[model samples]
Target: MSGKSSWPELVGVMATAAATQIGHDRPDVAVEVLPPGAPLTPDYNDHRVRVFINLSAVVIQTPVIG
Candidate 1:
Protein backbone atom coordinates (compact mmCIF):
# COMPACT_ATOMS: atom_id res chain seq x y z
CA MET A 1 0.00 0.00 0.00
CA SER A 2 1.77 3.08 -1.21
CA GLY A 3 0.87 6.42 0.26
CA LYS A 4 1.61 8.36 -2.85
CA SER A 5 -0.07 11.61 -3.82
CA SER A 6 -0.80 13.25 -7.16
CA TRP A 7 1.90 14.73 -9.35
CA PRO A 8 1.18 18.36 -8.52
CA GLU A 9 0.93 17.63 -4.82
CA LEU A 10 4.17 15.69 -4.92
CA VAL A 11 5.88 18.61 -6.68
CA GLY A 12 4.61 21.02 -4.07
CA VAL A 13 5.79 18.75 -1.27
CA MET A 14 9.22 18.35 -2.83
CA ALA A 15 9.61 22.06 -3.39
CA THR A 16 8.64 22.74 0.21
CA ALA A 17 11.12 20.16 1.43
CA ALA A 18 13.91 21.63 -0.70
CA ALA A 19 13.16 25.15 0.52
CA THR A 20 13.22 23.94 4.11
CA GLN A 21 16.52 22.18 3.55
CA ILE A 22 18.08 25.20 1.85
CA GLY A 23 16.90 27.46 4.63
CA HIS A 24 18.44 25.13 7.19
CA ASP A 25 21.67 24.73 5.25
CA ARG A 26 22.28 28.32 4.17
CA PRO A 27 20.28 31.14 5.61
CA ASP A 28 22.45 33.80 4.02
CA VAL A 29 21.25 33.43 0.45
CA ALA A 30 19.37 36.61 -0.25
CA VAL A 31 16.27 36.93 -2.35
CA GLU A 32 17.10 39.00 -5.39
CA VAL A 33 14.86 41.76 -6.59
CA LEU A 34 13.59 41.82 -10.12
CA PRO A 35 12.89 45.02 -11.96
CA PRO A 36 9.28 45.82 -12.79
CA GLY A 37 8.08 44.86 -16.28
CA ALA A 38 11.01 42.53 -16.67
CA PRO A 39 10.54 40.18 -19.59
CA LEU A 40 9.43 36.73 -18.54
CA THR A 41 12.44 34.71 -19.58
CA PRO A 42 12.84 31.01 -18.89
CA ASP A 43 16.45 31.77 -18.01
CA TYR A 44 15.22 33.89 -15.11
CA ASN A 45 12.65 31.42 -13.86
CA ASP A 46 12.36 28.99 -10.96
CA HIS A 47 13.04 25.90 -13.08
CA ARG A 48 16.26 27.49 -14.27
CA VAL A 49 17.08 28.42 -10.71
CA ARG A 50 16.60 24.80 -9.65
CA VAL A 51 18.81 23.62 -12.48
CA PHE A 52 21.50 26.06 -11.42
CA ILE A 53 21.23 24.83 -7.85
CA ASN A 54 21.58 21.22 -8.97
CA LEU A 55 24.58 22.07 -11.08
CA SER A 56 26.15 24.07 -8.25
CA ALA A 57 26.07 21.10 -5.84
CA VAL A 58 22.70 21.83 -4.30
CA VAL A 59 21.73 18.23 -5.08
CA ILE A 60 18.07 17.69 -5.84
CA GLN A 61 17.24 14.04 -6.33
CA THR A 62 14.02 12.33 -7.19
CA PRO A 63 13.07 8.74 -6.40
CA VAL A 64 13.49 6.09 -9.04
CA ILE A 65 11.12 3.09 -9.46
CA GLY A 66 8.66 4.59 -7.08
Candidate 2:
Protein backbone atom coordinates (compact mmCIF):
# COMPACT_ATOMS: atom_id res chain seq x y z
CA MET A 1 0.00 0.00 0.00
CA SER A 2 2.87 2.33 0.74
CA GLY A 3 4.65 3.87 -2.24
CA LYS A 4 7.99 3.15 -0.55
CA SER A 5 7.19 -0.55 -0.38
CA SER A 6 7.63 -2.39 -3.67
CA TRP A 7 4.33 -4.15 -3.41
CA PRO A 8 3.89 -6.13 -6.58
CA GLU A 9 1.23 -5.29 -9.17
CA LEU A 10 -1.49 -7.41 -7.59
CA VAL A 11 -4.13 -7.06 -10.24
CA GLY A 12 -1.76 -8.03 -12.98
CA VAL A 13 -0.57 -10.96 -10.97
CA MET A 14 -4.08 -12.25 -10.51
CA ALA A 15 -4.99 -11.65 -14.11
CA THR A 16 -1.95 -13.47 -15.34
CA ALA A 17 -2.51 -16.39 -13.01
CA ALA A 18 -6.06 -16.54 -14.17
CA ALA A 19 -4.97 -16.62 -17.77
CA THR A 20 -2.36 -19.26 -17.13
CA GLN A 21 -4.80 -21.69 -15.60
CA ILE A 22 -7.81 -20.96 -17.79
CA GLY A 23 -5.92 -19.99 -20.92
CA HIS A 24 -5.58 -16.57 -22.52
CA ASP A 25 -8.86 -17.01 -24.40
CA ARG A 26 -10.81 -16.66 -21.19
CA PRO A 27 -12.34 -13.22 -20.55
CA ASP A 28 -10.89 -10.79 -18.09
CA VAL A 29 -13.74 -11.40 -15.69
CA ALA A 30 -11.76 -12.39 -12.61
CA VAL A 31 -10.31 -8.94 -12.10
CA GLU A 32 -13.73 -7.48 -11.32
CA VAL A 33 -14.13 -9.80 -8.36
CA LEU A 34 -10.56 -9.21 -7.23
CA PRO A 35 -10.44 -6.09 -5.13
CA PRO A 36 -7.20 -4.94 -3.65
CA GLY A 37 -6.15 -7.37 -0.87
CA ALA A 38 -9.21 -9.48 -1.44
CA PRO A 39 -8.98 -13.11 -0.41
CA LEU A 40 -8.65 -15.49 -3.35
CA THR A 41 -10.72 -18.24 -1.89
CA PRO A 42 -11.15 -21.76 -3.26
CA ASP A 43 -14.47 -20.70 -4.68
CA TYR A 44 -12.67 -18.15 -6.80
CA ASN A 45 -11.63 -18.94 -10.35
CA ASP A 46 -8.53 -21.02 -11.13
CA HIS A 47 -6.77 -18.02 -12.63
CA ARG A 48 -6.88 -16.26 -9.30
CA VAL A 49 -5.25 -19.27 -7.69
CA ARG A 50 -2.26 -19.08 -9.97
CA VAL A 51 -1.80 -15.39 -9.23
CA PHE A 52 -1.41 -16.18 -5.57
CA ILE A 53 1.74 -18.06 -6.45
CA ASN A 54 3.67 -14.90 -7.21
CA LEU A 55 3.82 -14.17 -3.51
CA SER A 56 5.09 -17.69 -2.81
CA ALA A 57 8.67 -16.76 -3.38
CA VAL A 58 11.58 -14.81 -1.89
CA VAL A 59 14.26 -13.16 -3.99
CA ILE A 60 17.75 -12.78 -2.58
CA GLN A 61 21.02 -11.54 -4.05
CA THR A 62 24.59 -12.05 -3.07
CA PRO A 63 26.73 -8.98 -2.39
CA VAL A 64 29.13 -8.05 -5.15
CA ILE A 65 32.66 -7.08 -4.22
CA GLY A 66 32.48 -4.04 -6.49
Candidate 3:
Protein backbone atom coordinates (compact mmCIF):
# COMPACT_ATOMS: atom_id res chain seq x y z
CA MET A 1 0.00 0.00 0.00
CA SER A 2 1.10 3.56 -0.51
CA GLY A 3 2.17 5.68 2.42
CA LYS A 4 0.38 8.77 3.71
CA SER A 5 -0.25 11.35 1.00
CA SER A 6 -2.05 13.83 3.18
CA TRP A 7 -1.87 15.15 6.76
CA PRO A 8 -5.20 16.32 8.13
CA GLU A 9 -4.23 15.50 11.71
CA LEU A 10 -1.37 17.91 11.45
CA VAL A 11 -3.66 20.88 11.02
CA GLY A 12 -3.27 21.97 14.62
CA VAL A 13 0.25 20.64 15.02
CA MET A 14 3.44 22.63 15.09
CA ALA A 15 5.06 23.56 11.81
CA THR A 16 8.36 21.83 12.56
CA ALA A 17 6.65 18.60 13.64
CA ALA A 18 4.39 18.68 10.62
CA ALA A 19 7.33 19.16 8.28
CA THR A 20 9.29 16.42 10.00
CA GLN A 21 6.40 13.97 9.75
CA ILE A 22 5.88 14.78 6.08
CA GLY A 23 9.56 14.24 5.43
CA HIS A 24 9.53 10.97 7.31
CA ASP A 25 6.48 9.75 5.48
CA ARG A 26 7.59 10.89 2.01
CA PRO A 27 11.33 11.14 1.91
CA ASP A 28 11.33 11.80 -1.81
CA VAL A 29 9.31 14.98 -1.48
CA ALA A 30 10.69 18.31 -0.38
CA VAL A 31 8.83 19.86 2.59
CA GLU A 32 8.46 23.62 2.60
CA VAL A 33 7.00 25.56 5.54
CA LEU A 34 5.06 28.64 4.49
CA PRO A 35 3.96 31.46 6.77
CA PRO A 36 0.33 32.50 6.70
CA GLY A 37 -0.57 34.78 3.76
CA ALA A 38 2.56 33.79 1.91
CA PRO A 39 2.41 33.80 -1.86
CA LEU A 40 2.21 30.39 -3.46
CA THR A 41 3.22 29.61 -7.00
CA PRO A 42 0.53 28.23 -9.31
CA ASP A 43 2.95 25.61 -10.53
CA TYR A 44 2.39 22.13 -9.22
CA ASN A 45 5.17 19.72 -8.22
CA ASP A 46 4.65 16.12 -7.29
CA HIS A 47 7.84 16.22 -5.27
CA ARG A 48 6.71 18.97 -2.96
CA VAL A 49 4.59 19.38 0.21
CA ARG A 50 3.71 22.84 1.39
CA VAL A 51 3.12 23.26 5.12
CA PHE A 52 1.17 26.42 5.80
CA ILE A 53 1.57 27.69 9.35
CA ASN A 54 0.34 30.63 11.33
CA LEU A 55 2.41 33.34 12.95
CA SER A 56 2.86 31.15 16.01
CA ALA A 57 4.38 28.43 13.86
CA VAL A 58 1.36 26.21 14.20
CA VAL A 59 0.06 24.49 11.12
CA ILE A 60 -3.16 26.09 9.91
CA GLN A 61 -3.54 24.18 6.68
CA THR A 62 -3.55 20.46 6.10
CA PRO A 63 -0.31 19.44 4.46
CA VAL A 64 -0.59 17.38 1.33
CA ILE A 65 1.64 16.07 -1.43
CA GLY A 66 1.28 18.07 -4.59
lDDT, candidates in the order shown: 0.31, 0.31, 0.89
Ranking by lDDT: 3, 1, 2
Q: Give the lowest summed-lDDT range of ten residues in model 3.
A: 1-10
lDDT accuracy of residue 22 in candidate 1 = 41
The 10-residue segment of model 2 with minimum total lDDT is 57-66
Model 1 ranges off by over 4 Å: 1-13, 31-66
List CA RMSD, all candidates: 13.1, 15.1, 1.6
Give candidate 2's TM-score: 0.20
Question: After TM-score superposition, what is the CA distance of residue 23 in candidate 1 from its true location, in Å?
Answer: 0.6
Residue-level lDDT tens digits of model 2 in 1-66? 111112233334444443343333333323222333546444534332232333432212211111
1-66 per-residue lDDT for model 1 (tens digits): 223111222232334454544444434432221233434444432221231123233323431111
Candidate 3 residue-wise lDDT, 5-44, digit = tens: 8999999999988888888889989999999779999998
Candidate 3 accuracy as lDDT = 0.89
**Highest TM-score, which number?**
3
Clashing pairs in 2: 18-47
Instruction: Give TM-scores for every candidate, taking all chains together and pairing residue i with residue i.
Output: 0.29, 0.20, 0.91
